[model samples]
Target: MTTRHSHAGTPNPLHSLIEPRALLEIAALPAGLPLLASAERGDGHPVLLLPGFLGDEGSLLALKYFLRNRGYDVQTWGLGRNLGFQTRHANALQQKIRFMHFKSGRKVSLVGWSLGGMFALYGAKAAPECVRNIITLGSPVSMGPEGSQSPPLVKAIYRLIAHPLGTHGHLAQPKARDLREQKRMPIPMSCLYSLSDGVVPPQEATIDGDPALHENIRVPGSHLGLAFNAVVLNIVADRLAQPEGDWHPYEPTGLTGRLYRLLTHKSLPL
Candidate 1:
């Protein structure tokens, strides 16, 4: 079994407050170091990005611009704010994927963040033929309740918003839990997690299955800032550029390689 870094019992309540700090960090991007990748560029494939709960397309602007600059044709989940779940949202998303696949005549890659990550899993399950790969950032696809880390106040807000939207039934589905039992996804999958994630527990973010096609990348940052994290961005670019149907585990090199081994608490995949 792959070793996962997780809080032993309940997570610290204070961690939830730390989420806003990630936004502040992102606000400082203009003054921060620009990411210059030493890896291969994308082949101009189509990539779809999904935002987390309470987030919209604007939330992923930085990541979207970065990928666009790197050569991949990126599209945002044009749907409005991600409240929680709804069958209609899923249906519309499937249509979007199929349309892209049809137009490009190529399998589209799904990159979902947080709750959006859960959407990506369902998307891949629903349209494996149209999806080349699925990547999730800090999504609680495994440890639903445990990983959610939703305090009483937060839970209340979710209920109030989800009830009127009639998304509770859809969100109630146990498909995410079912993902854990599967040996592997029909499409290639990547799970990127942050050990210090405040919204979701890190350990429960990824699923354990076929090592060859399934990869768990441990990045360092808040779950909210994953889309803008330099390390995470580099990893995304590298994974997206891989030759389709010819997959391999990511092997970080140079200073990044050293950081991976030092911060990640497990035997190196190599």
Candidate 2:
């Protein structure tokens, strides 16, 4: 007898078990191993970095440094931690994005990890004029068929902290226009996901519709480790290097070409 397949949005408990690998990736960072090539460089545009749930700017230090070294003016999301929901949270985030756009005198790029990715998508939708593009790493954006890919522990913690803070359930919900714009995405967007991600399934981390404006890049790393993954960094650099209004999808090449082809699962546009 054949087993039935689960729906696209079904959660994967097995992937959740491997979350510990992220810790290993973090531990390896101190080894001083080279993670980026010298050839990579940005177009000097302002890029904002947002951390994952319960994460602060410190979690993205390596990524910021990598981008800075490549000539991109990178800024960190000043919000203390990613607590999912909270009153006026959406307004505050938009204010920050506007501030950056005004100060830079150009459309800014948003690079977010995990829940931060959701914010990035929201920001793009709320103010596409100020946003040039978006790049998400292991973020389970709700615009997809899947909602939150957070495991049981994370969900529990979110409920415990968010309820008291008044930023719980409903506050996190996107506005109707925010949802609609994200589905169409006026700005270019790139989603990077790893099958080995322990925090969320790969399917939940990628965009479901609109092939031309959205690109899903499959890389090798854990959900938590995506911020530090070499391949991820490379893709980030390449994407940021593109000139404004000249966006294009990413295609893995070079010595690792075969590996990328072998590892990626249905990343091309439909």
Candidate 3:
């Protein structure tokens, strides 16, 4: 007899149990500093960083420092702790993007982690003109096959602190489906996910859009530690370094590149 597993539309509980590994990933950050230091520097462009649910500017300090040190002017989502995306936050972000674009006299790049990715996507869609490029780290962006595949525990917590867990999150429910399924943003986007992520599955974190416009790059680490992952920072550096109107696909290099080539996912365009 053959035993099979079922598709439960949720992340495995075991991954949740090991979420503590995020700490290990954070502790190991210094080990990758040498390689990270070699990444291409920025061009003094403005980049906004958004943290995940219940996270605040504090959660993105490491990323801000890394990007700022590389010559980019990095700023954090200043709306205090992200208590799950809501209407008020969305409006505020739209204003923020406009100001950043106007003040800098250049398009602003958005770099978001986890739920923060949701905010970034929303912002880009709202004001693509003000935005340059987008990079998401381990965010739960539902693709074609998945429809808000949030774990039960996450769902419960979200409903309590944020909006109701209806079809598509209340943050961008009506447009959320359209955001992924149709009306793709014109902005260049890169999604970095970890196979080891526990909070959100890798599939849910990537985009299923035009191959030229969207990329699903895989990194190694935990969901909680993605913001601190060196491989992630390197990819962000490489992606951000691309000159406007001269963008191309990310060519993985170094040990991480070797590991990326080994992946059978074949993230090429459809």
Candidate 4:
């Protein structure tokens, strides 16, 4: 179902402002390389991280580092680049989860960003026995056709790219059957979204399932920032620390939470 915008609409100011900033932030990411250089490994349950569109395992390096230091067996989807929604993509990730389960003899936790989050959710539904918990950063799981809030120019470019590659190619539209399948299964989930996200509209990022099974945490940052933002890192750390069947929703507390709350007012959809 598509979310209807307010009819008394002028263009959404936040949407206009954020799109360019998201591009700028992405370009400047190289400067933060040193901060994520130190990788840490942890014990207990294994955690796998999935990066956003056009992202690779390296995009999640900072989050991996922080989770490792806090104590979790963190790893990346050794997949080279994120192309878009495709059947083969799911197969590749399912293989990874199966391997981890076999080797560790324990269920793993999944943390994914943007497109990666959708894949993680898909993986969980396909093999729920292998996943203990699922967390997503600015993933558009609920939004249907009109949910993509990209600029017309960007949308046009993606359409052009998808045409040559075929619908299941680089920019294929999400399959309705897949979405319907996902909605049928409600895994323990947490969706972390940003009011300041420049990519997806906040509402699109939310999970429309039972509140008890799914929780939404709102933060202040850009879409790219969620991967490395200290505030987001703390929330992830707190959630992963809980034991299975005793999972609790994250309520951002302390100085960082306060700071984030003070700086932002808009909440993104999980």
Candidate 5:
């Protein structure tokens, strides 16, 4: 049996090459709006949407617009392109989280895609007070040897551009200390990954922790499509829409709920 934390060998290299398939899901977004309309709406909470590494706010426009239309105060990571985690990125992200929480007069719900999702998890631990909920799309739980399952080429490219990605951040402490805290989420945390994800492996994206505060949901889409995929957005909306201080495992019930379950045929992780 496959445990939630199992690596199950390296992820398939083919998925990394076929990441372009995400474009199809993006193209299908418009047609899925009607279905999204049936999702639960929150109490006009604030949401901070973060893009994957190297991507900017523009990459997340579709999902941001979708959430905004649903009555959410959706905003982007203000620090331009996600240029790997550096001192500036860490400091700015911390300030952004605090500002969003204070400005909206509500705790900010974080919605991150790919590398952005990893950043969200990091931010949540550093500033748990400001973050109300955490939702990640195809984000690995750890970038180090512990959880990374990216293809060798992907890792090589990332290392070439941005060395020491996770080690240096706002909450950069003893590596072991940080890892320990990361395992214990102080707020509701949900992870969504696709079985056929082209970049992030399903195991790496899933979390192993307390059932009360953590859940790993399997969506159906390419890694690049996580931000625009209808099902992914729907799950984020429903998770963020939960009443403040109230969090629960996600089950298919929104407008696209049945379609998601039918397509993925996954029982979900809690």
Candidate 6:
């Protein structure tokens, strides 16, 4: 007898666990925070951070603080809101990249979460010479029916809230062309996904094409927790610590890697 795995409309179990946690995290996040006062002070290359869906620059404050404290020139989009996909957001991102390059006089690194990740990939594809490395957290780069593991109620709410905004105004549906084009671009890219993510499924985070240029790191945490989880933070720090032209695959070592492997084994098949 043979068992067949299905990737149809079935919801991911890990994603199922992430919904309530993400809601709680979002509610607890403080609003109207200030931008990095001295974004240009860090020693290494500059890093541009993008937030997930329905998330503004304020949502990434914790991650920004963490990187800043670690001595990185981190900057936020400073865009008013994260309503969805709009020409204005894209243009702002492009401008930010150009400004960073001009000011730093070096290729910048981009760390985007969810929708922000997609934007970062596009930015790299459009201008490969400007980006040094790219990192995405729980981004849905693969376009499929089961790309997202969000609960039905949550999905319903997103559709209800975002549908009226129209396709152009709202976050456009994931496209295979975008993923294909992104893969063709030559950039050091790392995708960090959690098996327990409640939003985007782990499989959607996998990149096809060259394994050397792309790496997939599996972390133990919920989708919301990934944005500020200690384990994820260490992984981000390790990745950012590397010098340009010296990218290496992330291998979690010692106790943390072992513990993460043990806890997330049921959800991720290595």
Top candidate when judged by lDDT against the true structure: 3
Clashes of 6: 1
lDDT of candidate 4 at residue 172, scale 0 to 100: 43
lDDT of 3 by residue, 101-143 (tens): 9999999999999988888988888888999999998887654
Task: In model 6, state the lDDT of residue 140.
Answer: 65
TM-score of 5: 0.89
The residue-by-residue lDDT of candidate 4 on 1-270, one tens digit each, is 113221221224565465446555545555544332322233478999998877888888878877877777889988778766667877888899989988999898999998888888778877788998898888866655444564455456555643344322432445434653475365678878765566665666765666666777777577766786655666677777777777666655555445556655533223
lDDT of 2 by residue, 1-270 (tens): 111112354346766777677777777765523436533588788999988878888999989998998998899878888776443656677888899899989899999998788778777777888999999898765434233545667667777766642323543455633553455566778888776677766666776645556777778778878887666787788888878877777766664444456555444321
TM-score versus the correct structure, for each prediction: 0.86, 0.84, 0.88, 0.79, 0.89, 0.79
Question: Model 2: residues >4 Å from true position, as ranges?
Answer: 1-11, 29-35, 143-149, 164-168, 171-177, 256-259, 262-270
lDDT of each: 0.75, 0.71, 0.78, 0.68, 0.76, 0.66
In angstroms, the error of model 4 at 24 is: 8.9
Best-fitting candidate, scored by TM-score: 5
| RMSD (CA, Å), each prediction | 3.1, 4.6, 4.8, 5.1, 3.0, 6.4
Residue lDDT tens for model 5, 151-206: 77666667666674532332244533464457557788888877778677777787
- Model 1, 1-270: lDDT tens per residue? 444454454345676668777876677566434443553578888999999888999989988988888898899989999988666787788899999999999999999998898888877877889999888888866654533454455556666876542334444567544544542675778889876777777666767766778877887778788887766777788788888999777777776566556666544541
- lDDT tens per residue, model 6, 4-50: 11233424765675456865544543421212221123456788998
Candidate 6, which segments miss by more than 4 Å at Cα?
1-10, 13-18, 22-43, 145-150, 165-180, 265-270
The C-alpha stretches of model 3 lying farther than 4 A from their native spots are 1-8, 143-146, 164-178, 181-183, 254-270
> TM-score of the candidate numbered 1?
0.86
**Clashes in candidate 2: how many?**
2
What is the Å distance of residue 234 in model 3 from its true position? 0.8
* Candidate 3 clash pair list: none
Q: Judging by TM-score, tell me the better candidate of 2 and 4.
A: 2
Better of 1 and 2 by lDDT: 1
Given candidate 5, what's the lDDT at residue 94? 75
